[model samples]
Target: MTRYDFLPRLVALPGVYRPQADTRLLAAALTQEPLRSGAKVVEIGTGTGALALQAAARGADVTAIDVAWPAVLAARLNGWRHRLPVRVRHGDFEARTQGLRFDLALANPPYVPSPDARLPTRGARRAWDAGTDGRAVLDRICEAAPSLLRPGGVLLMVHSGMCGVEKTLELLGREGMSGQVTERALVPWGPVLRSRRAWLRNQGLAGDSHEQEELVIVRAQKS
Candidate 1:
């Protein structure tokens, strides 16, 4: 069973990203953290606020932020339905969370390698379409992590292994935060990746015979 199996059914609205393998992996990692009651937690690109709600149910004060209005609405509604108090807000993660530091930071940012160079500002593509290198959002998250967490605070972020997991660790290390991959699960490529199979293979992000993608959770701590 998943870590969220015991919680009430979540309400996922259209256009908002649905909690999938990455979300489940991050949730499992969250269970391993030593969270005390009333610990401050922030979830960036919160989608339906699944991870934030998990922290809230465990007594952590959670603030969830997303760029889409539909996601913000879905998160607020889900929090009410689950009886979990989460401060769901609609805005960019860095803009909305400025000047705030938390004990724990969670993220499931876009890491898909898209053919397009510019990131999407709207539409469902925004959920998963990163730039050609697939590090558009991932790099930003790693760069902002130090400012988002307090001393000794931890960051739990999940992304596709094709997006350069080692680069993520290196970026965090450069920022003085040590990090390593804590969880990994192989999942079959969904429609998004399947649609770009040929491109991915040509770009060396995927192989012709491979149909599965490895998802990994990176746990980084601020020193």
Candidate 2:
């Protein structure tokens, strides 16, 4: 029932994407959703189930998915420890969400721009390595959102401005949803971003002395 105090109750296994600034921003946006009982929610790319727990605490029926088994375990354990009704699953989101229709969907997927066009197939890198332009996963989510959402359902996703906020809005628009950045925060570069700082600068995603990246939460709702 505590906010931003999940670390102690959460089961932090290796390779799991720990709750970070992006998680907090997306969770903050989630709190604005209608989370009354009977509301169905699906969270793609759930890490430790932070957002899922938040939604469940508000009375929404929350189901969360993560590709990593350890992450799934962690998420489930966190929900159990907190006595929240969050269903955590380990599998590819595309497969897990099949035939699923929800009143709300949430995601804080990997949007870090990497040097390679191919995304990581396994390991810790899978949590942050998006393609060179960083839209590999985001594009897929945009394509799948419409199908996953029920009428009047909404999707809230967070990503770095480096991935092009306008582009995300455009993709969601194409999905027949009205979308926009609803929340933004300037976050100092994390370890991963710091490690890729030089390449990011070369790609013009980062400026000289610009150690911060703007994170945005895009909210899309089906009319």
Candidate 3:
């Protein structure tokens, strides 16, 4: 069962990314993590702060960030409404580290492989469009995980398997972090994926008229 097996309803402001398969997949994996009491946690690309709220509910102090301003506002509102004490910040999650580290790091970043060569600078597209290979942000996170996590801290991140799970595991290993797929789920294509069905098929990221996509939750522990 997913931590969001009973995903609490949240007010999704216009233009904010709504929680979906990737979110629930990670949430399920989160329930398996060793979340100690009062453990300090951070979530990049928090979106509506749903996952951050989940971490908080586990009795962990949560800090979350989103690059989209509207998402930032929505997350803040949700945190306030739920009284989760999630510090929702609007900025680049990677650049705003400021030397702070966390016991656990979580993310469900934009991993939809798109035709566009560059990640969108604005709009809702920024929430899901990773460059052509869908590793733009994922690669950045893998590189930044070492800096964001304290020794032995764990990073739990979710993304489409279409983006290459092996690469993530390999990258984390290179950083001295042993990682594995703690959870995997095959979810049907949502509106976003459905709309880009043809493009995805052309890129071989999807099967012919593929109706489902695989999602994976990678759990990496920094040593």
User: Top model by TM-score, which number?
Assistant: 1
Q: lDDT tens string, model 1, 3-61?
A: 67633477778888988888888998999999999999999998888898889988999
TM-score of each: 0.97, 0.96, 0.95
81-146: candidate 2 lDDT, tens digit per residue: 899889888898989988889999999998999998988777888888899989999999999999
After superposition, candidate 3 runs with Cα above 4 Å error: none
* C-alpha lDDT of residue 176 in model 2: 97
TM-score of decoy 2: 0.96
Provide the overall lDDT of each model, using Cα atoms, as 2-decimal numbers. Answer: 0.91, 0.88, 0.88
How big is the positional error of residue 95 in model 3, measured in Å on the Cα after superposition? 1.7
Winner of 1 and 2 under TM-score: 1
Which portions of model 2 show Cα errors greater than 4 Å?
A: 5-8
The most accurate candidate by lDDT is 1
Instruction: Name the better of 2 and 3 by TM-score.
Output: 2
Q: In lDDT terms, how accurate is model 3? A: 0.88
